[model samples]
Target: MFRSIRHRLALFTYSWHAIGPASMLRNSVRWSADAEARAVDSGFDARYGTDTNADLTPGEADILIDRHHAATMYLPTMDQDLAAMLAALPWPESLRRDATFIDLGSGKARVVLLAAMQRFRQIVGVELSPRLHLAAVRNVERVRDAGALVSPVRLVHGDATAFDAPPGPLVTYLYHPFREPIAALVMDRLVASLEASPRPAAILYCHPALQPGFHPSVFGQRDVFQLAVEGGRQTRGFLLGWSVWTNDAWLDRTTIPVPLVSGAGEA
Candidate 1:
């Protein structure tokens, strides 16, 4: 309860600082209504037999709070947004079949479960919070029992910074999992992994923090990453955007007979 209050207060303070009192209040009201509507299962949960609708704040998860945790919150990726992200990947069907799909900071493994429905080589969810990791385990089991998973799912309970990307083609999904500090660490790890074992890789970042007040995303490394898709739409009064960053190696390999798929690159 106390943590929940603190979390709310922090959000209020941040919103006030960012948009002032009046606009903050207006956004708060609209966001609250939208959140409430989302809380109720809209057939996705019913069909999958999963409980991923709750917004699990750091406080609600009973986890230690740090600068990174404080900035992070758990909201399952919207079904439509995840679908759009998958669709935006430039990899052909053959490459996608051999690629591993990983979701960092996968809260309750919602994205993990959804990704399992695809024909990836493997699906992995790396989560830092123990509580959320356990929840993710249960959800994965439920999905497995229901025979809904095409690719085997693995849930790792650990920090994203320490996650070692398996060799071969990889696709990572991130939903603003942490602030810039932690994000930088995760990015370094990924770069190291790619360097150690050179391969085609891509990052799908939903609701990327690219605005002035927020820290810049590591995906902006132009020398290493090329913006493949950049677009967003208004959802429940909130403008949600996603950016797909493909490593230079992917672009280099696909430059020939593979035929590069076109998308709205970064301006």
Candidate 2:
């Protein structure tokens, strides 16, 4: 617990240095209100709070940090921003009905619940932290009991890098889940899956890392994935960037809409 407090303090210090005090204050006020409203509307605890890794046991922390090179903290993606990102995708309704939606590093399964409300064939959330996974399970149960889920939902308590995607059309979502090494491995796994199955696949990356970048370029082979949409939303003046990449064989580039950089909430 002491270590977690220190880590959070260090993160706050860095954010204070990077964005200054006024912007930090504005974001905190606005985001807290938004989280409250979302929680009330959704009937679940999907608020922005705590780094999930902070709750990890010492042995778990050591193994994750030392062996995986994955240490990105958990922050729920904004409901509005995720909706805009999905709206930007030019997929046909028929395709959406056939494709499975998967949220990688799905903390508390907020994204999974949102996707469940969509027309996807199924919804899956892969989370590494046991603490977050249990919370997600509870939330899923609540959604299920309330009959709010349009599609079936599954929560997997496991590492994102090793999760094998089901074969067929897929829509994978990520919210800057991890560092470059693990991100690269996840991309490799996706590429291999596409190669073996040769199906339509799209990747939705929200709040992409800017430093030591983890973008579509991480896919390595430029011929496989193409950047279909690149945009973001501003939450009380703080920019949240997102991008969509489609497999080369899947999308009809001519049919895709121009990048959404305004109104929908791009800064």
Best model number under TM-score: 1
Write model 1 residue lDDT over 1-267, tens digit each, in one string.
Answer: 997787788666555544568776656656665565466535678887877776666656655665333346677887777889889888899998999999999989989988999899999999888888898998888889998899988889888888999988899999877766678788888887776677889989876222222244576543456788876656466666788888866547645575676778935
Clash counts for all predictions: 0, 0
TM-score of model number 1: 0.82
Off by over 4 Å in 1: 1-23, 36-41, 67-71, 208-217, 248-267
TM-score of each: 0.82, 0.73
Deviating ranges (above 4 Å) for candidate 2: 1-69, 208-213, 220-222, 248-267
Residue pairs in clash, model 2? none
The lDDT values for all models are 0.76, 0.71
